[model samples]
Target: MNRAPGDGLSAGEVARRLGVAVTTLRSWHRRYGLGPDQHEAHHHRRYTRQDLSRLEVMCRLTGEGMPAADAARAALTVHPLESVERPRTGSALSARAGGGNTIPVGGAGPEARGLARAAMRLDVATMSSVITRMIGARGVVHTWDHLLRPVLAGVGERHAAGGGLVEVEHLLSRTISETFAAVPRPAGAPTPRTLLASADEEQHTLPVEALAAALAERGHRSLMLGARVPPGALAAVVGRVGPTVVVLWSQAPATAAAGQLNGLRGTPLVVAAGPGWPRDGLPPSAARPASLGEALDLTLRWLPTAG
Candidate 1:
């Protein structure tokens, strides 16, 4: 059905369509000059088709982890003449010419190269699609170790070198998180016998997320407590849940306290994952997995057997 000229959707309708809060729409309008363009006598402002299109762009970009200001700017610049569908393979990263400043993938394959290019252009759709395809074909462990990790490390390297591409890193991280979350778990899998979390004061959860998805592929399940889980909270959850195995991840030395493992003293297996842990400081009972593959294998072995 074609929307007639001068007929526009109300704020509530637009919000429902976009899957955003009504207040979000108002804030986007007030902050970014993205409100309705259709004004009628004695009635509230209404969003025109063009206005909705711009808002769609804004929502997509922001959802993929672009800063609100940058997303709004990109939204404003989107013309009605552009195609509304997801970008084609060759055309997605067309904005970047010559690939001079692209993210360094370091001997990775075409998929990683394409992902880096998409990330550099901040093309959310292409980045997500590429990641989802890779995960589907390669499974979580391979995709994380081979495709995602190298690109993420490259993004980190670039950011460290010049203090730039923070937005790109955020976008790429968000995309990876979403893709992992969308992976399907096996049917009729036993109740989760393992728990995964970031170490106390740790903010990195992507590795744990990857581990969870990998376990799902093998018909095992885990309870994932994302970023910055405190030591006390970890203890409380372990006591209450009675998980057979617990994996605590710390991405930096600052968050990897050996005492955190002490909190899980009674758990049958405590795996200290990530690089943050000091080699000598780990608890004698805790096992450390050096890579995603090793982590998955170790955790699977610790899962409870069916009676």
Candidate 2:
């Protein structure tokens, strides 16, 4: 698949254009057989235009959270000259018949259902576009609670049922994370007076990311110490920042050590969030906000206004 010298891109150039690390490209090459197809004696390998296109698909799909293997498989199927078109609304649903697999979005609306299908297909471009549009139209909280959460729950449910859409779950989570990160924070907003982090060993940080984005939407700011903050580190951050409000999140019971909350006793308003915490075991001084909406409300109320 080697092409003329001028028609190929070096690994670095491809990585730069694709917004991925060179190391990631190497890993994809090594693990998934998705490397430069052009090589010469005593010379470095170069990626053909087709190779670059395939890698772009790989990066987008994996960035959206598709498993590398699955993304690579999908990427390899594309012809070099073929344009990657956006998936049509409900197209994923229509394509699912006889596939013996589907993401159950429960009572979610068409958008959520469509998102679930897109996720199943590892359609990152479409997924991201859908998320961005939804956030713009419905606001972060509405999109999170209604569209994103339902699809995420369905992905989780399918995985729990042993149908195994781990790639879908990962891709959807990544897409949501990127969408939230893209939210525009207000200029001249006060320094972040709120600190947010996940409990130790709690890898689920989407809720907090959503909360941060939601805060940004309202012109509030927060320091999001994403996922798995050890108790000592958490305490050190609190001591250093002296934030007006500190929120700790945990996504599973195993990560919900009450001691983490207890360590933040001196923080003015310590809130326990997510479903991982035991109802009775939370630090007596900490408040538990039941949902993202409640958490956002509490954080806002406790956040000190900047001078």
Candidate 3:
């Protein structure tokens, strides 16, 4: 059973967080019986917050020349509460507790993951409840990074694997994308004139809207071209907008369309984001964004470089 206040940390997690070898932690647990407090029926080991803290302190003390036994004793004697912890009520931290550090969907917390599950199961009311609660509580960006992004990524994967039923995937994508665009941007930001388009046959534009939002947030302007844009049209938009960068999204499993980007060489910054980016055969005309976060970084970089 997970003792009150905290769930058990897996053995691997404990070792990684404490900067110790798995073997070393296991040996200490065996020799000094300093292991975590719970072992479920499946033989999965879990440790409390207190247990992890104790281990951390023990490791710190031992690193500073204290003996292992002495370190262990000191660790067991101290218990510092997490900042997110509320006294009296004693509720544990939410999964989104540690800002920017998102736990995986399978891990704890119901807010975002629950919304995702509900959406996947086509439970409309539950999905609405979760999203409304999140927006009411933490605002849009928080919901985006901490919840929406993960959920979309999950949905996309499930859709690929024949998991998204009927029109669920399209509905979820449109709803989330439109919601993102609806969130008000701060007034008179950069507003840089730029075109947002997806390459030929690359129908995924979720990343495009996301990239546009990020750019808008930073004061650069964007013109959303949406999905399935051809290269000639893309080049024309660049000429019309005179944007510092022309952001493109592709999720088609191959960069064959990327070859068409040759028309955009020196006219504008050519940035590409999606799951379909080539690992080895990318042309120099386009840059690959490793993740949404990375895409944001690249956009920021383009701002200063923009004429």
Candidate 4:
């Protein structure tokens, strides 16, 4: 709802106003071919006030579950703030489900609702406070599993469909990962039996980073090799670390079933945690945690002395 006087807004500022990231804005621009009027040298992006206003509306609509392309077209066609809302799929549909599979914390007072909003917006400061509350109440592992996962899953569904603000999700993921990873564990904590890393072609590593951070908080050391770690490198790390539990995240099930699964070898327990994980036909040695909390539970069971 906020706007500056001039018609120009920096790429970072636009992302901040829209509650996303500069990189995300760039991705949207590239993928959907939407943008501000001009760019500075080196291909930096800039938006006029009209452009910013339109993008704001577009992001809002998309966040509410409209596809980015449709939202952009609608934003261009109509006044963004008008009462008439365009019918689109994704966020709007999920929101209209009246709080379906999302966190059931409807009307948990203004603070909780505000926390949810801040999270949805990817406000770093507010998200920090929210995470602190979650950790205090549910412990790091449970908070990650129950609260963060659902919210992020919803966000991811939106992003994949070009409905969610990609930058916001990226910012939130980095913020949460860093915050949780920094929390100290007791001395002499147990080492996890398994390690997890993303396979080649999987660009989404934030989920696994959060999972690793939660595991670390519980006194189980898990190395996060980051996105697109080569399967061969992973196999080497597994050989050296000898982790009992190995976790993999795939945004697409078909990709994992075909190629990413090549990254999973030698580990007795393999857990694939993501929306793309198969509901059935998983190998007996492999399992799905549904959320970071469930993954931590398995980690704790394997390393009972942790925490």
Q: Candidate 3: global Cα-lDDT?
A: 0.61
Clashes of 1: 0
Candidate 4: global Cα-lDDT? Answer: 0.63
- TM-score of candidate 2 versus the correct structure, residues matched by position: 0.68
Better of 1 and 4 by lDDT: 1
Can you write out model 1's per-residue Cα lDDT over 1-62, one digit (the tens) per residue? Answer: 34542478888888767656677777766666667765567998877788888888876665
The TM-scores of all predictions, comma-separated, are 0.68, 0.68, 0.57, 0.57
Which residue pairs clash within candidate 3?
Answer: 8-47, 9-47, 190-219, 191-219, 191-221, 192-220, 192-221
| Residue 293 of model 3, lDDT score | 73
Give the runs in model 4 whose Cα sits over 4 Å from its true position.
1-112, 119-122, 157-164, 188-192, 258-265, 279-282
Per-residue CA lDDT of model 2 for 147-174, tens digit only, reads: 8998888888888888677777888899
- Per-residue lDDT value at 62 in model 2: 51
Task: Give the range where candidate 4 is weakest over 10 consecutive residues by summed lDDT.
Answer: 95-104
Per-residue lDDT of 1-307 in model 3, one digit per residue for the tens? 3334366777777766654567667755554445675555777778777767767665555433344555555665574433222222122211111112121354424455555544543545455556555655765446667777777666666666655344666666766676557555556555555667887777778777777766655556577888788888877777666777777777866544557666677655677677776666656667777777777776677666333
Candidate 2 lDDT: 0.78
